[model samples]
Target: MKSLTLLITLLCFLTFSVFAHPPEGVWKKKLVWKEDWVQIWKTVKKEAWETKWKKVQVPVWKEIQIPVWKEEKVPDWKIVKKPLIEEREVPAWKEDKVQVWKKITKPVWKLIDVPVWKEIQVPVWKDIQVPVWKEIQVPIWKEIQVPYWKEIQVPYWKEIKVPVWKEIQVPIWKDIQVPVWKEVEVPDWKKIWVPEWVKMGIPGEKYLGKDHEGWEYTSHDLWRKKLIWKPVWKKIWRKEKKQEWKTEKKQEWVTKKVEEWKTEKKQEWRTEKKQEWRTEKKQEWITKKVQEWKTEKKQEWKTEKKQEWKQEKKLEWKDEWIQVWKPIKKQIWIKEKREKWVEEKQQIWRIEKKKVWATDKKLIWKDEWKSYQAPIWKEVKVPAWKKVWKPIWEKVWVPNSHGWD
Candidate 1:
């Protein structure tokens, strides 16, 4: 009954009004006996018998201890009573991982002073210099001052230099004829270019042919008048040297052809051979070749025999006048020796004569180029204006490939 009383009193105290503040001088405790059970019923405005009906419609949720009594049969009643003790337990200790105050981080910014250049767009009134060139034509002549002939042939890339003037032109884009830097151009006609004679390739000096005609062609030497010559007698005359006049006709055995070559036995040539053996080797060789040649005796003497070859031949002609000729060595490479008799001064020829350079070649620009004021450009208020500054540029033509005005 004592335990039952403690349980009911605790339940009655818990059921009391929680909104009431404890009065002064009154004990306030969480656990109380059934002494406050009347207060709980009064606050609800219901008698103890009606308490059940009062709370019937109101939802009440609380821990209530209803003592359930049951008698148990024991083998030995009250043999020994166990000591009354409160049970104690160890609780698990856990640390909370949730962050209380997290620090927020952001990128740091720095104020930087940057340099800027502003480009202003404006027309520049520069005295632009331009050159106006006139055409200069160079003649492609065979010789220095002569027109090319039918037989003369010129090759490519033959060049000649002629004096030309420098022209300075003013763009005249602006109203004023202010002169800029002098710019010149060498017009195609005005420029002296490859000449026909120059393209003739060393004027028979440098040639692929081994020799020119029967005469020798020598390499050009500035120091000496005469140079060495290799006879392309081998190259140009390779066919002539190795030529065989072969007539591919139907060949037949002919006793007549062989018998025709057989000459009558002449005692005049073979019988007196012992005396003719005294002939000089050079004369013998010349005589042998001359005898082999098939021609009229008179024609052979006049054609094969020249004044230079006279020394090697015998004076066999029965002529009316006895003509004598000069030495043969002096007559080489000469058309004739009669020119030697002419005045020595008259024989000398001047190649380049009466050639002069001309003036007024290129255009000339006016003199405002020295100190000309350029167009004014201004920019304000725009942040981008401070970023760009460009210079003014002008162009003009140059003379020829190598020279300029």
Candidate 2:
């Protein structure tokens, strides 16, 4: 049994030795840079990290915002030159209208000479020309006269009062309202200035580290970085009042007093001795007032409850927030080294053919790095058709048997 166990152990050891990994095959043991391998998605939707998120629109990164070459607005000669302006006169149309007056004919009575008869009292009727004598009978009509007019003497001009019209020029003065223009301040482009950093790129947080920050050419995935900055949120605190209740008992005293009043009943006229409550309400009214006071106190509690909510909100805000640090990648630095190996150990190889015993045999090439000398190629003459076409293999070099020495 002991021999059998020993044989089984030996067989097991041999089996394990055949399958063991080799210790020395270039080892391939080099510090490889773990690239910043991150697969960015709109959202990590596989698990609890799934949440509503907006896709990073990558803001058309290639929109290389090359600064617009604005043509400097140099004031041109035409713009600076003063233009000629002229004042023109407009002719006004003129027209005149003239008025003329013509004299009108009116009836006029010419009196012939009538001799005055003062003292003789004889009727003085002068008819110096009997052929031209007019009728002496005048139509005399007496009208209702005013008292003042009856007192005046007829046909005599004593002291006379006249109303005279005089031409007067009434000058007019008017008030005029004028519009005013207010001065408004406008920003001057000459005063506008931009910083060099702003001119290079849009304003954002700049990452300063040795490794690749934003863009990497080694990976097909576009690089995205997040900075978890701890925000210093502001704190606000305020105080409110807290109320306490105080109750006192004054030996439960009661006062009794009588008062008289002309208390009119529904139908009977009478006097009533009413008990006057000097301080508090009547027992029934006091009970009702106590209930009202209790209700008002509850209303105060409702107002105080709202104040508590503000404190509750402040407690809710005590939660902390986190900011992520920037991610980076290590640079790959390769160095050239000299190495020696056997013919079978050549890493790179190519397939080639050689002829042996009039048959073609494929062979793998082992090219070694070495110095070479270039020789000028020369062409040998052959048949025209043979130069155009390639000849098939016919024979091979053989030293001992089939051919050449």
Candidate 3:
């Protein structure tokens, strides 16, 4: 009984509880027991007996143990225990492949132009002064006196004295110029004589007798021639000369010069050579400046990549259950042996820790130094020639004056 109880206690202790699979990469422990007897119980309640006069009821349950047995033959038993070791070739997990990239740089070269300046010496010409002498002609004047003659007329008058004669009348009385004489008449008696002889008578007797008549004597008157004288008056005429006054007129001449003298002016000139200069324009070439631009590409390296790794695993396990009954108090258990099976699994992963750096194709730039040659020019000063003129003065003589002489 004690052995049976010991066996039952062992079987109860070996009862197993199922559990989920453990996490990866962790260690786990499991329990196992080998035994044959099983101990179990059932619970029942006791009821009270009833009679016609009274009935009784109970509410409590009680535990009870019952033993069962089967008739079978006892078999021989042996302990055979072995550890499960599985050998599986886990193909290496596929490793990840990574591509690397990088950048690179390079250098280039070119040519260009540059500017430069230089100076040169030049020459020039200068002018100077000079003096000269010359002669010229001029005008002069003088004064002088002159003489002339002329004629004129004169007038006069004269008077003279002379004698003149004329006749006049005169009256006069004369006394004793005419005498009145009477002559006596003693007549002719004596002259005439009668003859006496014839008469004889007495003279006396004739006288006395006128008284006596007789032949008487008578005296007779006689006429005879005689002379007479008388006085008379007379008128006379005579011629004489007379004096008178009268006037007279006459003409004369005058003279003078023709013109007068005055002063005058005149001018003179000379010739000479002179110096002069002139300028001209010229053309030449000079240097100039220009701008330029250039462009290029360069490359450099700058990238890194990592290698990949993964783990592989395999599992092997065995399971068995058995039961048996005998007519005696002894129990029995059995185990069977069979072929082992192994499972296969594969995984792929990359190891992120390992890395390597590599250069990629890219553009790179660099500057290069070089030299170029070109033509050079310099300006130099040189002497030049031009046309010029020079001037001088001189004097000479000439005629400029003319007038009446």
Candidate 4:
């Protein structure tokens, strides 16, 4: 029991110690690449040649008779008509009466009215009311005051005291009762049986030789067993009490003294007087004169004369000439030609062969470099400490005229 208890206590202590603290920093993985030269198998093309059947054009020349054309001139005649113009005096116009314009002197008179304008100077006067303004000086009496700062004694916070609470750990000792098991011997009893013999007789028994006359009697010995209890002792485990002392931690409250700073406010005042000036205006009236104009017209009579022309028709006798055409026999000579064609044969083209440069594709092996990503281990930076602001009280000297009004 003691060994078991000690084993349990040791396991609990190991578990608590393992979970108390944790590991710091972080684990990181990165990818890295390395350059190296290696052999690689690749497909490449090369030029080669082999024998093959190819079609070609062959050129041949042969000569045969071909047709040739010849030209000759021949004379021919034709008949055509001729035109002539003759002038002979014949009566084509006759004398007739036609009206014509004649000029004569005549008198005409007309009465017309004409307008004439004349300008004259005339005086015009009008009565009108208009507004007029005049500037005058006005005295404006005003009392003005300006603000100024005034200093005085005022109450302000100087220092302060505050109570602070803090936590502390305390150790205490305690007594505990623990049960103990021990091996000991105890007394006990058990019962068992044994076999024993006893004498026995039968009543009214005759001679045993006669079997059938009287009652046959026989004597037999009987055996029996009895049970009894016996005391015995054995070794076993027993429980016992024991007292032990243990150490433990407890929380307690404590008080402390701390000093802090405070702020206060106050007001100030000032006054002043000044003077200013302004101006005013008024209205006035006046009279004006202007000039005017007028127009007049009159009528008069006059005489005019104009000349015109008229057309007339008359007939007179005149002479004219005419053109006439007549048919006559005349010979015209022209040149002509004759053509003939004949059958012939000629050669134009033939077949031939040529040689040229060409390329072909094939497979080969080559070596090159390739890139890939590989895993690697590297050292990286991690944050261990950080900056933080803590609250604390501090005292400083402040001036009275630091704020605005």
Candidate 5:
């Protein structure tokens, strides 16, 4: 069993070491670089410029034959007229005799029957009654006493305690100590060189020694003096007083007087007058005038005039003329110039270049071979896993009353 376990452990260790790092002891070929001089052919382009001339058409102004206008006036005839005397027949007015009707008016007297009326005075009687009023007396009203409730406030005296403070002096005694200085003669201490062996043999409580060669210093001694202090304090006291106040409330019953009145109806005697009317028949005279008309014969004379017309011969002068339009010829002359665009040959010079591309190889640098280290890769073999049936025994904790342990 120990031998088998050792073989399995050794195999696992070898496998882990082989896969964790790259393999060594492998040879590889590398390229070496070198420099040399060489020649090559390359293409190049060239350009050449040339001058040429071209013909173009241009516009110019020139003198040419054109139609000209001239202004000229011709003679024109017009008709004229003069005044001449002539005779014509026209209507005129003349005095003539004619017979006409005339009307004349004359006054005439006539008689007719007319009615007239006269007015007279009349009297009428009627009965009337009148009413009379008199003065009267009225009674006055009196008041009585009534009972009601009213509220009023009652006051009382009260006593309360209040705090009051009074100032007073209190004596406090305290003992205080004050520092007092005094001069004394003392020996001053100073450091001196001592060997380690000598310092070790000396006691810790013993000092080195006093300087005896006039090197002593003067010092003072400390002393305390007794003192007493007294402080002042004040005390507070409480006191009470009595006070009186007046308060009102609505809780009282009182009586008051109110006035009330009533009205009574009674009959009284009065005087009044009444008026009465009656109708009566009686004769009365009234004056009235009436209008009447009658027919009568009358004569009136009037004169009338009429309009008359007659024909008479007379002489009148009139002026006449005729209007005629005649055609007249005129000529107008003007000076002008003309211009046109003509096709003419013109020489224009320009510069042109021809490009020729040629390939020429150039040798700028030589090729070089360099040597460098190259990495070499190798295939590694891994062990394949196979299924093996075996029993696995594991220790697991079974839960009990206590926690897992």
Candidate 6:
């Protein structure tokens, strides 16, 4: 029986050695019973089944901002002067001399005797005497005595005294009492039911220390680029005006005054001085004495009467004119202005606003503030699931207890 136990023990030892963990061999010698060995075996098997999680490198990133600037170009301008021309009319001056003649007259006189007649009145005077009488009125005065007497009377008035009466009045009053009504307010009471609140527990007491405030590994994606700038220049062109001077020989008509001597058939006038006799009859007046008498109011007046006597006499008169020869000269002229419509060819410079087009290309780069996340290398821990062994009591069948059945 000892031999059988030894063999069975050797067999169990070899089986445990084959399945045991390499680090658990030192504890296997101290085990006594099969139950304890089985327990150790299960511990070794659970140690092999449980697995350890590994840590890997992951990328973490953050975002930031940056600022940049750029540049541009502009144009400059200026002004200049130019010349222009136009056509107009101008006047010229000249003078001319001429010859002229005029006519004149002269007078001659001669003395001769002439006979004439006139009518005159002669006055005659005579003395006359007359007597006249006049009458006038005269006044005479005499004295006499007379007497008269008058009498007058005056008036007067008298007044008497009188009396008058007036009336008076009086008033009386009495006291009175009045009653007034007032409103009164009354208070009313009522009963109502109200709900009361009781404190149950403090809010958020269970999760006081469970706040997420730690750093965690995250991934972000971003890109990188570069900004470059280049300078370029463009030429500006415009249409401008330039003045050029030119002269041309031209023929035109001018106005002038011309004097001309022309012979023409005309009548001439002359005067001759000769002796001529003229006869005329003249008259004279001779007055004779004539008397006229008028009687009025026994007085006599004598007057002389006037008479006209005419006498005729023939008288000789002569007028003479001297013969004279005179020379007369006249001048003639022509007044005219010569003109013609003419068209002239000229060159004109015109200033026009013109624009020239050109193309200019330059590389322009602007640095703008950019914000993004970039990836970085870091280590992070993650949770992994593994199978483990648990010790528990279970009922199973054994070979024998103390006696065989």
Highest lDDT, which number?
4
Ten-residue stretch with the least lDDT total in model 4: 266-275
Which 10 consecutive residues of model 1 have the lowest summed lDDT? Answer: 34-43
Question: Which digits, one per residue and each the tens of the lDDT, describe model 5 over residues 1-405?
Answer: 423744775685578658866323233332212222334333233343433333344444432334444333222332322233444444434434344433322223223233322223333333333333333332212232222333332232222223234344433334444343333344444433332321111111222455433222322122234342222343433222233333422222334332222223322222233222222333233333323343433443333333343332222232223232332333334333334443433222223343433223343443322334444443333444433222223332221222332
Name the candidate, 2 or 5, with the larger lDDT value: 5
Better of 3 and 4 by TM-score: 4
What are the per-residue Cα lDDT tens digits for candidate 4 across 281-345? 32222223322333333333322222333332222222223232322334443333333443333
TM-score winner:
4
Candidate 2 lDDT by residue in tens digits, 112-179: 34332222222333323222323333222234221211232123222222333444443333444434
| Prediction RMSDs, each to the true structure | 82.7, 65.3, 99.9, 59.3, 62.7, 49.6
lDDT of 3: 0.29
**What is the C-alpha local distance difference test score of candidate 4?**
0.34
How accurate locally is residue 342 in candidate 2, as Cα lDDT from 0 to 100?
24
After superposition, the stretches of candidate 4 with alpha carbons farther than 4 Å from their true spots are 1-155, 161-220, 225-230, 248-405
TM-score: model 6 vs. ground truth = 0.13
lDDT of 6: 0.33
lDDT of the candidates, in the order given: 0.28, 0.29, 0.29, 0.34, 0.33, 0.33
How many clashes would you count in candidate 5?
A: 54
TM-score of each: 0.09, 0.11, 0.11, 0.14, 0.11, 0.13
Q: How close to the true structure is residue 166 of candidate 2, measured as C-alpha lDDT?
A: 43
- The positional error of residue 60 in candidate 4, measured at the CA in angstroms, is 99
Q: How accurate locally is residue 236 in candidate 1, as Cα lDDT from 0 to 100?
A: 24
